[model samples]
Target: MPLINSDTNNVNNRGAFILFEGCDKAGKSTQAKKLFEYLKNNGHSVELWKFPDRKTTIGQIINEYLANDKDLDDKAIHLLFSVNRWECRKDMKNLLLSGTTLIVDRYAYSGVSYSVAKGLDLDWCCSSDRGLLSPDIIFFMDLTAEAAEKRGGFGEERYEKKSLQEKRIVESSLKLIENCNQLPLKEDLWKTT
Candidate 1:
């Protein structure tokens, strides 16, 4: 059963906020969209969201960087990613409070993992996202870099390359999620289907 908050009066009581995180081609967006549709079809209020939204001003910048059209320092791009999330933070909170479930594709976890894999300080990466609303349920779609590389869109984006960095990012992501006390048990962390 989905976890529910006891405060009936709180907006969070209406629906759970779920996030999907994983490497490129691991189906985070695909699964998030499917879940969003499933919930909506069941008469639940649900919204699908993606990081580096690519629609907003900041997101556009991220899009350019990811497309290899622009070059940014590792830390610069990292902070920009966090800032992009901050731009949506208030709206996200409002949606949850309004009894809507947000099926989000990626979040702070991605920011931290990718940056940490690039040799950035883990504490700094995490601290940059402080105060962002935590997900009620987070699903990490575990896929080996080799497996992901075989996918159709692999290597299409800057971060989609199958390199040692990708492997390191996966390792960092798993460790970070494992250390998160608010997350589910380790056995429940990987969603493979």
Candidate 2:
């Protein structure tokens, strides 16, 4: 994840929605924690939310799938992930509206890209998350697939494979917000890590 910030004119008087988006082991969690602590230490209101929030009912189902305890159709698991985000949409909006900065690790981008890489339709993958709160900024963490494989416990997750992770870059997922003009999406889509 890039560890960056984003803002949109539609959301006023709200805390920034800082998002860290990337493949597994790209240091998204590491960076999100640093930003959260930095904001808290500075006396700023902040909250950290991770997707597949395994504590939720839907999340638990998704968790089982990711853990390989259960199997789901590609489309089924994709929607489950999207629903997990939807389940928290209200809370996320409330926090943002209350001026609480939300540091999110992984989100719709991950949902779409991972599924698409696994052979799901991009439009279908994006449709379910159409109205979700947009991140003020998306930090696209960049790390080579080789580098990620070298990270500890790399193969633990179901989608942590190098071949898939390489195709799982943020640029492909940026299409999720292509219609949103306020976001400063990079024109250069060919990012070589």
Candidate 2: stretches off by over 4 Å: 1-12, 174-193
Compared with the true structure, the alpha-carbon lDDT of candidate 2 equals 0.79
- Candidate 1: tens digits of C-alpha lDDT, residues 51-72: 9889999999999999999999
Pairs clashing in candidate 2?
1-141, 2-139, 2-140, 2-141, 5-137, 6-136, 6-137
Candidate 1, residue 66: lDDT = 94
Clash counts for all predictions: 0, 7
The per-residue C-alpha lDDT of model 2 at residue 32 equals 99
Instruction: Return the TM-score for each candidate structure.
Output: 0.86, 0.84
lDDT of each: 0.78, 0.79
